[model samples]
Target chain A: MKSLNLQRVFARNTYLISFILLVIVLGINYIVQNNVFELRVLNNNLRTLLPLILLAVGQSIVVIGGGLDLSVGTLVSMLSALLVTWVTPDSTPDQILLAVVLVCAAGMLAGLVNGLVVAYLRLQPMITTYATSFIFSGIALLLLPRPGGSIPRDLSTFYRSPLLDIPLAFYAIALLLLFWSVLRTTRYAQYLYATGSSGAAAYATGVPVRVVRVTTYVWSGLFAALASLTLMLSTGGASQANIGDDMTLDSIVAVVLGGTRLSGGQGGIAGAIIGVMILRVIRNVIFFAAVPTWSQTLVNALIIIAALAGPGLIRLIRRSIGR
Target chain B: MNAQTLRRYLTPPLIALLLAIALFFAGGLINPDFINVTQAINIVRLAAFLGIISAGQTLVIISGGEGIDLSVGAVVTLAAILTFRITGGDNNLIGVGLLASLSAGFIVGLLNGIGIALLHIPPLVMTLGMTGVVSGTILVVTQGEMLGATPALMSTYIAKPLIFGIPGVILIWVALGVVMWLLMERTTYGKHLFAIGVNRTAARLSGVRVERAVIITYTLAGLLAALGGFMLLGFAQTVLLNLGDPYRFPSIAAVVVGGTMLTGGKGSYWGTMSGALVLTLIDSLLRAMGLAEAYQLIVFGGLLVLLIAVYGRELNLRQ
Candidate 1:
């Protein structure tokens, strides 16, 4: 009975396990490169990781709200395409600012489409987003048929520079966490969790289930737009139609690693951020470990599979032991 | 027939057939040659690849519990590469190549089934992860060098014009479709699949071997996807790095458009056939229209969303 309770507690707090895993990976990364904590390395890594971190945070909300947004990557592409295509070389700061606001709004609008379709039309989230993904990418492709556009170099340089002795990315992370903590205290968050955990029960309990679900996706879209902005900053505002495609899967992996149940109503964004960190650190390990270029993709995939399967295996073992 | 009977007859396939006919005429309006008999053959020939791939997809979807095989595209690619390596364009080694591809698919399907059933991983994540693993493995193994040529026998018989100027692949597709139809509609396994899909615990309580059925269904899907890859090799005569990428989403699109629920359990293979043809016709029409790749993608995506919305909305309302 005691063992069962212990196992149950462990299962209940998967984030704790993820934290340990993150620490272990960081330790390994430090051993590989002793100067990993140097400001330069930290800044470079954090900046590179910011986009995925933001994406995973968005994805966690959707997953927690019992939906999945396959188009998050495409949304990123679309916004980036819009930003670079509109923000020409000689564009004024006001124009750039206006373009940013419009692109973010467009992202929210796109999310509204997804939310409306999935929540109101009652379409399956998986297939619906999958289809819309093409639409988003198609628009992105139309905006920039080829991958040749530039944001202002000064803007990119400014984004790369540190602010007040700390990297800009740290502040961004802090802001996101603050937003999440504030949101968590709201009744809507409780409703969101209730709806995801059991929609029928939540409805019976007078929760506005549909509204909560739709808002979650809308929130996802806003975060996706933010991720796109950070990605553009990191990549010097160059845009590709498929730039965000790869990150879709990576964010999902991060969410799973962070102990967010795909089934819904479990886990949090904090774990998701840690999950992204773990994935990035592992990528760094693979790079520094001198793995062959040909085998790199395969090695990364294998590690992902391991990470995705690990928690499930633990739960299974726990169940068997309990029995 | 009464309205109820008529409505029953107007299944997703029949609806798809009607749409296809309209699209066919629309294509003809764009270019008179599009309505020719040759065009019909071309459409079916193109659809043969999707049909075979989707045959397995339909089964997986029917197995339910949010069952889907996102790895189909990757599996097809891996199978094609492995077959090419095994056969090396040698007709004599074709049998060995087929066996090699099917075995590879079986192993993957088995792993997917085990993970989803015994290990309790979500099908979406499990298959998606499998796609990465399989694609990554292929990249490492091939090192960007895709080998092997289409054997003359396959090209001549299966791909090129044969008896009555019809491709052999279309005939094979018909045969496979019929067999899958019978297997799903006429057999005990079919009933078991539907039951398990409808409700797993209930099915288990009723003494259905749910795990075995799921395992078999996924294994079959994997094998068929590999077979489809072989067909693609025959048609294209050579494989490229992203050869199977095009078929990945379309197969799923076709399956869904054909009336299969994404949530699974209730659908028909016949519906999927028309869905494949409809999707193929759209592709041909888009190409014929001289649309850029971007527009083509937009149309494809938009049409799929429209179809899903049209079908799915009614189901939700009824519920």
Candidate 2:
């Protein structure tokens, strides 16, 4: 295994490249600032980022199954606003849990609507998700004309606390990756990949393509609900209008960077986690290095292009060598 | 022409525009002044802005290959920003501003074309990515500032009727509609683009420069989008950071609702022209009735669903 081409293995999983990049970027920052791996800064950034990472993971699931759920970002913002506003300051832990469950149920119902529309009415996924974004934002804005919320002291401390001198958010993500990997080996995973890679082929093999496609969205909604909970807690409240706006854009970038094909059927949650980490890390690197805003735009674009270019280059090389 | 062909050509746009008018009048009964002449003139002019943007959107979609420009709004905003910065205070700088705006627009189109055509990137993702870069560039360049103040006298003239009843904007719309019609119906370029869109493999087999067609179509779309942006120079009085934003989705909406197939093969420029006007009327009428922004969105969503139900086949959402 060691001799069977280790570089080839790294080239195949984009997350490894991003992880290496993350290390290099952090190293550069440490060398320059002499922060020497500060836990405080890392925790501070990760708290703001927990919701997005969760959102991206949910998006990755659906994208891998050959569908795009534009509603998850909207769902995150909507559910966060609703849960925060509805869960009053006087609510007990059990009541808060009930409220959280209700939010997840609502998200499930919304996803059910989206799935039915796309499957039964045969609406385009992009348009379907887009229309729901409007519906969700409307409800969100109506619920709170401005940002407001209060997490119980216990919950706030729970999110803010460091478990074993490291951010607890990191631990939750590690657990999520484990769950994602375990699920990857299941029959549902096999069907999902088969469906995304080629729906017609999967259908011929009795994969129940429609059921998997539709169910993926429902589960995505559930994941989004969990994300919203963390997000609201992380922010210590909700903001009016698109609290999760960046998630939609960043999620796509993260999924794509994580080695998932935009066209669908590749990549994993580990890859997506790395993708998010890379983005979050580079942002800090930019600020630390004092890169100008204008140059940063071009640099980010170049990096995204480079990340995508690798797979294309490997394909080109493979074709030449095979011929 | 056969009766079916004639009806097919005329019905969708007619129904769509009529529905919009009906909604506007319904909104008018509630607001009272929405049915008046001044309102009519304003609706027509505003429709022209969306119509120009949709004109470009229609081509990009019609050229097919799943090629849609998400940068339409950003390009327009960038164009607006550049025109303002270059022209600055003097009215004479309008010419220089236009040129500068156009060149910037072309560069955006070039980037989009390279991503989609040369690199074989997915249109939706490529455009989405380009949007981030372009919008970020806008923010970085502008530092969140607006530029260029329009001349008050020119504004009054632009708002007034060019001859007896039609305003300057209506005239531009009419001229654009005619040009688009000719290019689409009577020209070889239009035929070639449609051919490429419907089946690129077949087009390639037939010796069409498929890459060049996709590239040039996107380029043209960009140029036209910039033209729409510059026109706002006189209309909006000053180019703000997001003047181009409102134009983005509405332009695509106009194109889609106007009877263009989303998969790109056959489409109607005249339909898009009416579609643009119809959407503007709905928006303005809603505003007149004192509908809250939230409810306006609700109505907008309902309208889109209603439109799709009526014209599902044309949308190609069936397959």
Candidate 3:
């Protein structure tokens, strides 16, 4: 009975594999770069990784709620563009605060548009977001036709600075986790899981699945906006239209690696955050391991594919062994 | 035909056709050169590449189970680069290049099929991962070097009018469209595909070789994409990194715009063909209007959303 209970615990812990992978990769990174754990280095790494962590967290919410937001990356680009273009280096504190609010609001509005289309129009979430990505990218390009914008030097320094000898990113991530924990306690979280697992069943149970779906997208948009803000601050407010294009796929990869089923209904933000760390550390390992630049993409691709296929391959082997 | 028959048989492609014509005329309004036959043929010629690629996409999508070929763009780039490298701008080695690129495509597709069908990997994830792998391979092989040019004969075949001022590429596209239509409409394989798309378990229960059919579908998609890439090589006359990047989303868009359900089980090559035309017309019209690239992107995306909203709405729960 105890063994069975342990097995159940192992099975139920969706983050187990991701956590293990993160530890292994982090170990490798530390081995290759001995100073990886230094506060300054850690701060620099976390700052670089914060944007994707935020994006993946948002993606996880959507995935858990039975949808996806392909436009999240482009939405990041659009929001970052808006922030940098509107809030100049000389902008007053009030202006900066107002611009930030408006940018985040715009992101939510975009999400609302995606939500309405997917829920009310009953369109495929993937295609809907794919289409909207172009719109977001277009808007980004229009707002920042060239990659030139500046935030105040002080703001960037503040963003990069350690607080109490710990990275500011650590505090930010802790706040995010706190917010998620509070949100997790709500009934909406249960409804989200149920709706994702089986929308028809949830509907039959009077779950208001459509509204749940819409809210998930809204949450995704909100998080994507936050990610954009982090990215903008990290880059010192330089904006490019296609800045976040590559992050979309990477975000999906992180979500999947985090043990979130791409088909939806399982996993959490913690696993996704860990997944982002694994990805970031993997890059560090490659860099420190002195992998040839030309072959880096190849190596990265192979690792991702291997990681993606690992669970299934393991299951297949287990079944064969059982047989 | 009866109204029901007409709606069933004609409405989707008809919408695409009308949109194409309207966009063409709109371009003409901006610049009369757009209305001429030469320009019209030029649009079709350019669209042939996308139309051909979308043919493969149409099949994969119709095979269902969240099927999509995100690797097509990577495959196209791989094929174009491979062809250029193998042929070395020599007409004598053209056949060798074709054979090599198609085989590469086949292998990639076979792996995709196995991963998705046999291993139960989600199609989107599998293909997306494969895109990364293939693109990475491209980078490794080329090492960021630009090399080789399209052979003279190949360029002429793609660009020059052959029969009554019709480009050879257009004829090739027409022939391919016919083949795709017959394959989808007249073959048992097609029936099995549609059945699998609608419901995989039921199709399996009814004796469809679901795995084989799906594997074959993906393989064919790879072949078609490679073919499109080879033709693109001729059209462009040189290989560039990420040569197929631009074609990726547009191929999927063409399929969707052509009224193919993203959920799969229902669509046609002809609809995709017309959808390709519509997209090409939109491009020409935007260029004719002399809009900046940013504005063009905005208009294009907005119009796509508007079009999809009009015809792509899914059936509600009650239905």
Candidate 4:
């Protein structure tokens, strides 16, 4: 009976909502394209959303931990620009590896900077992240101009490579999910959640609130680098400017729709995955709906309003009923 | 109030205006055209649109503790594009254009309000979600194409100066500013709005109908954002996809720069007014320098950080 109840709960869980959206999209795609099985096609698009997914997941974690990562999109853009400008085919395999390592390291450092500013300096999370995003993207643009890149053949293949009709992004995503699962079980995640729920309460209970807050940003930054890496591979390269232009909002939307609270301490990454699926599926719907391309924004606005509204509306109904 | 409290309360807007003046003088030194009558008029006109949006933004932020309306940008974009699309370059359709744009925004705003108020949603996350939804809608509707040709009548306002070099756009802005000030100060509804923002629980205790207050504030923001969209259509002569991009956060920045707290409870329309002009001058100066978008963004970022530091440092030290 307990297992059955758990199954029902998971079935209705927002974290699982995106998976349902994925299934629904595939069903529609199969009917339209007349191919019930095209694992490769699904993998390819998921690959495209991979970097964004990473950013979204990372952002979700931060928000859940009581902060917002407004800079994730810009950070990805900056990293994309940095790698494209610094790494070349002639730079040898070792050089390429070194560049990758450096970029990730730099990303972590940037995240630390943001975390410290928010946790120690006690700045507003959104504003602090927004400022850092601008700075990071500036540095990125200083390195490269426009959106052109020549990512090495090996790097591109690894990101886009098909294994048994499944794209590599799926693997990357699976690995990240595993990591998050482990992280969730650890003391760090517990401390992060406790701190977010109430800093005073957490500190009173002997939690290292400041360190957790700062480290969460570090985690967010590393995730951002990973996101940019996947995007760089898929896009074939990056431009210093506007590389991750859309990632910031997309990630935020995903996190929110996945049932994570932006105010912090009441959400998780699992929901972000589903949020990405719903968002991507919605995009696909726009293509088929034959709406004027410009109308896409209007439709997006409505859907987002709906997504954000739905949860609140449900809660409101429950409260009113209770009253 | 004590001196310390007064200074704490006054820093955000005071610093913002000071920065604007500093940037203006700096720009004037670099290029005198940056401070001419024509330039000043143009900046006012642009700031008017932002003011309208921020007017609504201030109310919402005041009303909810975690409240913010990030959907302002997307709303402006949607309204601007729709106004052009329906008008189809025809002057006769100007009224229709305005109606459609406003209606779209209104409906969207209503949804946002419902989500935030009745549903007990955190306004930031709620609006953030709406941004994607609206942006995706833009992509589908515009399909990478933009519309130009705002009703020439609107353009004439900018072209003709009724006050000896003061463009009609500036006058329209001033008029709107006066009206907003009146609405916020003299009206019972406005008082209620202020009450909710300062203290939600206390306001509710006083029978302020907090939910209604929040809903109306968001709806007001929606209308103002649409108005900004309409103005942009006339101002730019083309409804670019990302034209409204700078408006959203800039309006928030302007409001903050002018004296509004992100945590809500206190803000000034006049401060926001000054804030918008200051931001406009900064950008106009940067554009005059013919710098690339990247450099411009970096400078703006640095400036914002500096202002935050100056203002926030004192506050942080106090707390």
Could you give the fnat of all candidates in order? Answer: 0.58, 0.17, 0.55, 0.62
Ranking by TM-score: 3, 1, 2, 4
Highest-scoring model, DockQ: 3
lDDT (10s digit) by residue, model 2, range B1-319: 9998877756777877887778777867887777877778778888888888778888998888666777899888888778777767467777787788788878878777867777676676677667767777887777777755654443554556777776776788789999988988898788788889899999889988888888888888888888788777667777776788877767877877777766787777888887897788777876787777878776766666556556644222113
Candidate 2 has a TM-score of 0.89
Q: How many backbone clashes can be found in candidate 2? A: 0
Docking class of 2: acceptable
Model 3 ranges off by over 4 Å: A1-7, B1-6
> Over 4 Å off in model 2, which ranges?
A1-36, A200-205, A293-302, A305-323, B1-14, B145-147, B151-159, B313-319
List, residue by residue over B106-213, the lDDT tens digit for candidate 3: 988888888888777778878888898888888888999868767888888887898899999999999998999899999999999899989999999999999999
| Runs of candidate 1 exceeding 4 Å displacement | A318-323, B314-319
What is the C-alpha lDDT profile of model 1 across B47-157, one tens digit per residue? 988999888899999899879888889888887887778888889988988898999899888888888887777787788878877888888889998777767887887
> Per-residue lDDT for A68-122 in model 3, tens only?
8889999999999889888888999999999989988998999999999899988
Worst 10 residues of 2 chain A by lDDT: A306-315
Docking class of 3: medium
- Candidate 4, B241: how far from true, in Å? 4.3
Q: Clashing pairs in model 1?
A: none
lDDT for each candidate structure: 0.85, 0.76, 0.88, 0.76
Least accurate stretch of 10 residues (summed lDDT) in model 3 chain A? A2-11
